[model samples]
Target: MTTWSAPIYVYLWLAGMAGGSYFAAFLAERFAGYNQRRLTQLAIQMGVLPAVLGVLLLLADLGNPLRFWHLLAEFNILSPMSMGTWILLAWVAIAVVMNVLYRYEGQHGEPGGRPIHRLNGGLGWLQFLFSILLMSYTGVLLATSNRALWAGSALIPPLFVASAVSTGIAVLIAYILVVAPVTTGKTTEYRLPARLLTGSTEWAIPTRLVGRLWEAEAIVILVELVVLIGLVAWLGSSAMAGAREALNMLTFGALAAPFWVGVVLLASIVPLAFDMMSPGKELARREVFRVALASSVCVLLGALFLRAVIVIGGQL
Candidate 1:
């Protein structure tokens, strides 16, 4: 067996998680009316770190990190990595702006109350748009690679999106549960206090919004599984069976546990079950938190495994 460096895969996983976390946090804050200050703050803070690290890892993997300026000095729209670099830079800028706005709003209490909130609302939409692009670009970056398995596959972007959504939900849910009392100032009530006390005619909206995002991600996961299986079957039957066999080293060999258990069963199936069963009621709070946290960790692991398997499989 030939050995290979796998830091790039790790970087990809981290970047995807960061992007997804940003997307989830932005959407949850915008649509759900969920108001845990620490939750949003933590998400914003943690989300940027991975993207920065991923970029650094990419540079390091290139054997000369200093040469990174070449990407910007000489732009190439045709290159996915080049495109990804620009997209990532743009996303970093947006995240910084959102962070500043968030802090400013907290300190200043929104100009004239409603007008400042309105401006924040506009900025919130921009944040969400950029977050989605940040998450989607990871897939686009991989899909742009000339590698046969990664190239020209419609399913890759969606799969990456699904993975992002899954991990994003996970990170948000974990943060909410971890810092619930600090944000809500009530340790006893399991339901998000932000929803109940806000009185905005939009109570329980964030929970429902999160639930819907989870459901959409689950659907995408199903589609991804189907596509991956179909590709394996088709490759096995065609002259590219050797390539298919190497890929199966992921499914049936080394990476099987993570692929089946973490990705398929834990990240996708289990979350779908909980999401379908949970009602936006205080009674279901414990169960909702439990499932969300569990699935989020599983999805994070699955995302890592997905990249690891692909990079390793390709080298094989």
Candidate 2:
């Protein structure tokens, strides 16, 4: 019998998203050049809410939320849950501080902003590392359960990480489209704001930034596809009956519809197709936002359904 509940499923999903957001933001800051500040700010903002909520949910699921502090009082290096609790506590503090600093920098316009920005950047790296650990921790927690569906293989962590990244990129893309200013002309258009975190810059900068983000999202989607395939293949070849049973449940059993319709098609394939056919590159700025918005919605839905199917299906 399964002991986990809906809250657990949601907790897993939110935790992964939070981790992925931080990792994505860190990457944007490191490689996105002028766009780093905006992405970093967006990433941190995106991460903190879900993360804090997820942690709260996890604690609530314990029946007495305050009991979570017990884990902190009693340290156990060998316990995944204890470690995760500590990590969550640390991440929440860091995320809150980062958000406050980022908002201050943006509003005040670089009065001693350089040092603060650098400090945030340093913290971003910590977030990046913690995010990966957090992503892996969810799977590790499941695997530690000794259930054949989860414990039969070590691939769950990698698969979860890949999906988390793809979902994170989808979220950022959606956010950019929703929040960024839109510019349209006869032949060229831009979807991001003219003035980013550093202040008013040329339109060309954000244009290039969007292009890079699009390309990055595409790459992450491709990677997710590959990882999903590999996970299935590994499960198929597993000698454990439990593993094979879990695989069957996911592929052709009660959960098949969601796995196929939500995870494989809507989340992965649809977005890929939309990216290839998006008119945003042309004069259709509206079309671009529409496509991005649609894909992001799909990815987010798929991610939620993916977690639901996996958690519930495993028990079934």
Candidate 3:
């Protein structure tokens, strides 16, 4: 019997996405400084929404949203399901707190005062750690499972983590593109405030800030592609008959269309091409954002399809 349905597949994807975007933004906050302030704010603003949505989906998958608390009340060190439940619960709770902190800063803070709270620095680290764990938990669950497609596969965890970061970067880039205007409008339009992060302002592009997101996104995309290829190879050559069957299903059988088109082409090759060929610094500011928006949309679509293949393929 299939243990997970389509909703579960979607839940897994959204959960990883939430973790990735939140983690990357805070990480950039540390390295990119004030230039990336909007990135951090937007990331925090977005981080919790998906997580909340994923949780609702999870409850729906359970067939009894009201009984979710029963699962929370128990612990099973031996069960991946048990551990995933707690990790997700903690991740969502932390995200809520972090989001509230960011909102509070946006509304009550002075024009020139400190933007983020020192307490959030500590919370941010915790959030970062949990995000990594949350992303990895999905793969770890599969790798430890009895299914021939997932069992004993070492690449699964890193593959998921890389995809999470890749998708996360896409989300932030898309958010930046929409929130921060690049048109040569009046200075007041900048959301990247001279003192705060806004949607309309920066007459000149923050090339370095955008560059950081791009470089990181490209690197993770490459890593995900490598791991994905390695995973296919590993499964194809496995001694297990079930593993080999799963490989065939993915490579040339029923799952081939989604795996090849959605995961391989859309997720890895095409998006990588567009994302890396980013508009140059001399390019018109509006054009730069256009490319980013395209990349983000492609990456998100690919990510959703990736989990669909993984979850469904494993069962087959």
Candidate 3, TM-score vs. the true structure? Answer: 0.87
Evaluation by lDDT, superior candidate among 2 and 3: 3
RMSD of each: 5.2, 3.3, 3.6
lDDT, model 2: 0.74
Output the number of the TM-score-best candidate: 3
Report the lDDT tens digits of candidate 3 across residue range 1-316: 5788688878878888888997787787677566435555566667778888888888998867888899978899777778888988888787677666655655565452255566556677887888888898878877788888777478888888888888888887776666665555522122443235332334333546665777688778899999998989899788976988899999999899999999998888887787657745222355655776787888888988998898889887
Compared with the true structure, all predictions reach lDDT values of 0.62, 0.74, 0.76
- How many Å off is the CA of 188 in candidate 1? 4.3
For candidate 2, list the clashing residue pairs, or say none: none
**Model 1 ranges with Cα > 4 A deviation:** 1-5, 27-43, 112-123, 182-220, 230-234, 237-243, 270-288
Query: Which candidate leads in lDDT?
Result: 3
Q: Clash totals for all models, in order?
A: 2, 0, 8
Where model 3 places Cα greater than 4 Å from the true spot, the runs are 35-37, 106-116, 185-207, 279-284
Model 1: which residue pairs collide?
Answer: 32-206, 170-296
